[model samples]
Structures are given as C-alpha cells and as structure tokens.
Target: MPTLVLLRHGRSTANTSGVLAGWSPGVDLDDHGRKQASAVAERLRPVPLAAIVTSPLDRCQQTLAPVWADRDLPPVVDERFGECRYGDWTGRKINDLVKEPLWKVVQQHPSAAVFPGPEGEGLAATQARAVAAVREWDARVLESHGKDAVWLACSHGDVIKAILADAYGMHLDLFQRIVVDPCSVSIVRYSETRPFVVRVNDIGGDLTGLLPPPKSAGNKDEVDASDAVVGGGAGTV
Candidate 1:
C-alpha cells in the first residue's frame, strides 16, 4: 500500500478575484499564500515521501518549492495534472461567465459540463486525463520503491477533488463539500482495496499521529481548522 498526499496550491490572486485562470501565466501565489506554503511545508516534513509531484503550473510549483527544498527533493512535473482548459473563459471573471446561459450547465452538472468556445476541455475530459495520470504515477512509484512509498502531488483544488472522488467512493455531487484550502494537504492510503482519507482540510500541518516522528523533536496534537472555508464556486474543474 502507498500513501498519497494531495496538496492544493496556495491562494492566488486569481482565486481572490474570482477569475477563471486556467493555464494563465500570471496566476501566481500572493504573499499570504507564500506564508501558508511555508507553514504547510513545516507540517509535512515528518511524512516519509518517496517523491513530490506537481502540475507544471507556476502556482503549483511555487507551493511545493519550500517543502521540496527542505527535503532536497525535486518535484516531478506532470502536464496531466494541469488545470482545466477554460479556453475563452481563461482570465475572465468567474461571476461574469456564470451569468451566461451555457455556463449554467456547469453549475448544475459539473460531471457532464463542457466548456463553450474554442479548444475548451470538458469536465469529463479532465477527469479521464487526471485519473490516468495519477494511476500512472502510483504504478511507477510503487513498482520502483514498493508499498511503503509515500507520494505527494501539488495540484489545483478541482483537480485534487476530482481525483479523490474517482479514486475513493466519494459522490461527485459532494465534490463541493471537500474544502481544499490554499496550502492544505489531504492524505489517502491506497492498496488492493479502495483508498481511505486519513485527513481532510487540515491546515497548519498537524500530522502528529499520521506522520512518523521527525528529528525536529516537537510533538503536538491540536490543529486549528479556522483557515478552511466553504466553497463559493458554483462549479469545479
């Protein structure tokens, strides 16, 4: 069995502005996001991760930088984990697009929703692609390092949510319920059996019981969940 840790990138300016920044170049993490990433890295230091993977997107890469550097591990960038191709909606205000009739379909039925306009990739398409990518990563890591290997993936909220829903038995509708806060980490263990979530929406990195003791030698049990918030988005990628 391998334990997979999915890390959502820290908050970006696009997130605060309510814009669809799919593949947009300027969607980097803000100062607060950088601090959050550092906190998460400190909390995750105890986990015996065999590899750290990330979407090639700048935000994802930035979020993983501190943790990756601390562990002296380089992140394996995978294009498959990149965000949904919003096409024409890229760099547009989320509120503006939701007002459109066609975009409403996504709000009501994300599993079947398709992006309108040129070269857009649908929810179903992203689901299929990301799932395959995760499976491939799991297979390769497990084959090379065996079941005890722990893997971390730095990705977007929707991407992590969708992958978790597919791998575990979580309802697609409850996708909105899983709060992936900026710099938050979710852990899942996978074997011949289905995956099980060890923790969800954990912020400030309290991995006490879940992680083996680290050389830093500090022990703590209390974790504050105040940083998490309800999903305001009508639909996810």
Candidate 2:
C-alpha cells in the first residue's frame, strides 16, 4: 500500500482562544496558522504526493490550500477524517472541561468516553470511522498510484491520533498518549503483515509556534490550555 503522510491543521482561532472547537463552524486558521499552512508547501516540496486527502472542515481545508493550489491533484474531502463529534463539548474551553468528571474518562479510558449531547459519539466510534477511511484510501491510492506512491491527508489532531493508533495496533484508550501538534507530519506505511509508523508528531516548517507563548493580558494566570505540552498540545505559542 502507499505510504501516508498525516498532517494536522494549523493552529486555529479556537486554539488561541482556548476553545475545543470540535466540528465548530466558522473556526478558521489564525494568522500564525496561515503562515504555517503556507510553509507546508515548501516543507513537502521534496515529497511527491500521489493524492491529497482532507477532512471536510474549514481549518483542515485551509491548512492544505497552499499545497494543493500549486499542484494538479485535487484533494479528496472525506468526512470520516473529521474532528471528533464533541457535541455539547463543541466550542467549550479545555480548561473548563478538565474540571468535569468526563475529562478523567477521556484521558484514561477514551474507548469508553462519549461526549455528552445529541451529536456526541464515543471515541471508539471515532476511531473506527477514521481507520476505515484511511485504509480504504490507502488501497485506492495504491491501486491507482502504485505501491511506492506517497499520499497526504489533512485532518484534526484527535482524528490523526486515532488513525495512528490503528496503524500501530494500539488500543483506543491509549490514543491520548499520541501527540499531534498543528502542522506536524506523521507518516505510516502499510504492508501485508503490519503497518509501519515511520514518524509520529514530527514538528517542522514553522518555528514561531514553538517559541514560548506570550503571557495573556487578561488573567496573569490565564494561559491557553491548547499550549499545554501533553500530546504535542494545541501549539498556541
């Protein structure tokens, strides 16, 4: 099968504002994220991608615009790779959510974690859909582009982590341990026996987001929860 390059969308407005922004509409990439998106073109210049896949979300779409704009291959927008259906959690701040009991389940036993609200779905379901999408795309790409072909997919952090978990045969409960920073690249290649995770959360292209975050003016203690170092964080620097 073709090797897959998983790219998480650049930092977004929600990221800077300390919001989860899961499947939230009108959440576009922030200024710093725009620059990171542009740099992605230059960073991947050396790799010849046979196909481009993306989640049907604005942030992911915008993150990939620069790269596909200059290329002949149009991106395959797949909803399966979209952000986790946070439902009531959508648009909520991470700091506030951390105080909820569900937070513990999400961190420790994500396989059993299900977001509250009408639109919510369990983390296990999210992994199943995302993994299915990637495998289907991999086979399609391999058949059309050949076994040595390389492809790219732009998606949400959690969605990418779930896919990587499947690739490594890791349990969904442990997916939280994988950190996929904004604009980072994680590569995986599938063979007859097993999938090879070539890279995981490989940060590159933009350095500005890696510098220490600026102190928030509002509350002296107020810091963007997205900037936390756990699992690569939200890159709010």
Candidate 3:
C-alpha cells in the first residue's frame, strides 16, 4: 500500500494560552507555528504526495496552507480526522483540568477515560473512528496511485497519536507515552500482512527519504516496498 505521512498541526493560540481548545473555532496557528508551517513546505519539496487530507479545524488547515499554495492538491477535509470532541472541556485551561480527578484517568488509563457531558467523546471511540479513517484512505491511495505513492494527512495531536497507536498495535492506555509535537511528521506503510510504522513524532529530518526509488529497466528485479529490510538494509535510494 501507499506510504502515509501523518502531520500534527502547528502550535495554536490555545497552546500559548495553556488551553485545551478542542473543536474550538478561532484557534489559528501562532507566529511560531506559522514559521513551522512554512518550513514544512521546504522540507517536503523533494517528495510528491499522491493526496493531502486534513482535519476541518482552522489550525490544521492553516498548518497546510503553505504546503498547498500554488499546487493542485487542495486538502480533502475529513471530519473523522478532526480533534476529539472534548465537550465541556473545550476551551478550558489545561492547568485546571490537570487538577480534576479525571485528568489522572486520562493520563494513566485513557482507554477507561470518558469526558463529561453529552457532547463529550470517549477516548476509545476517538481511536476507533480515526484508525478506520486512515485505513480507508490508505487503501484508496494505493489503488489510485500505486504502491510507491506517498500521502499526507494534517490533524490534531491526539488524533495522530491514536492513529499511531493503531498502527503499532498498542493499547490506548499506553498511547500517552507517544509524543506528537506541533507540525511533526510520522510515517506508516500498510502491507497485505500488517501495518509498518516507519517513523513517529518526527519534528525535523531529511524528507527526501519519503520519495520512492527509481525503477529498474525490468520490473522482474523490483523489490516489494512493503517488505521490511532485514538488518535495516540500505535505505531508500
């Protein structure tokens, strides 16, 4: 299947304010975040993405603005990729939430955590929908663009973390240990057998590695992109 590049949106005004800002409307990227967004364009210049998907929230859209500029790939907005519905916790300060008893449950056992109020979504539910979204997209991209195709999806921290957990087969309770920083990029490639997590929570690194290697004169000698290289054999050419 095609390679999947997971990007967490850049820092937002809520981040500086120490607020949760879940599903908040006006949370655009802060100055530092805008810079990070611009840098993403340069880092990804050498790679050609088959598709770009994004959460409908403003911050995730803003984070991809530079990457989409002067390009034909307008981002496809997917609601399932949106931030976890925090319900009453939306726009609340993180400092205050940490003091709440539920915060410990969220950190120590997210699988058992459920936000308060009718609008609130359970952590387990978030994981289910998000994992399904990526898996669906991966299949679509692979069929439309071929095995070597690379793709990008810009989303929130928790959403990306949940997707990564599914790829790694890790329980939701252990997901808190994974840190997806602002504007960071993670990679995953799905094969017929299983999903391979190539990288995770990468803030900055060489992205040329994302590009598929050149094809040989004959297809007979081609190696399967989905196959893991034993002894971490020579990386992408």
Q: Which candidate is the best by lDDT?
A: 3
What TM-score number comes out for model 3? 0.95
| Cα RMSD, each candidate | 8.9, 13.6, 1.4
**Model 2, stretches more than 4 Å misplaced?**
205-237
lDDT of each: 0.78, 0.85, 0.90
**What is the TM-score of candidate 2?**
0.85
lDDT of 3 by residue, 108-178 (tens): 99998889888899999999999899989989998999999999999989989999988898999999999
lDDT of 2 by residue, 151-200 (tens): 89999999899999998899998998999999888988787667877678
Q: What's the count of clashing pairs in each model shown?
A: 0, 1, 0
Q: What ranking of all candidate models by lDDT puts the best one first?
A: 3, 2, 1
Query: Quick one: best TM-score, which candidate?
Result: 3
Per-residue lDDT tens digits of candidate 1, residues 153-219?
Answer: 8888878888877766865655655677778888876666566566676776356555432334454
In candidate 2, which residue pairs clash?
A: 179-231
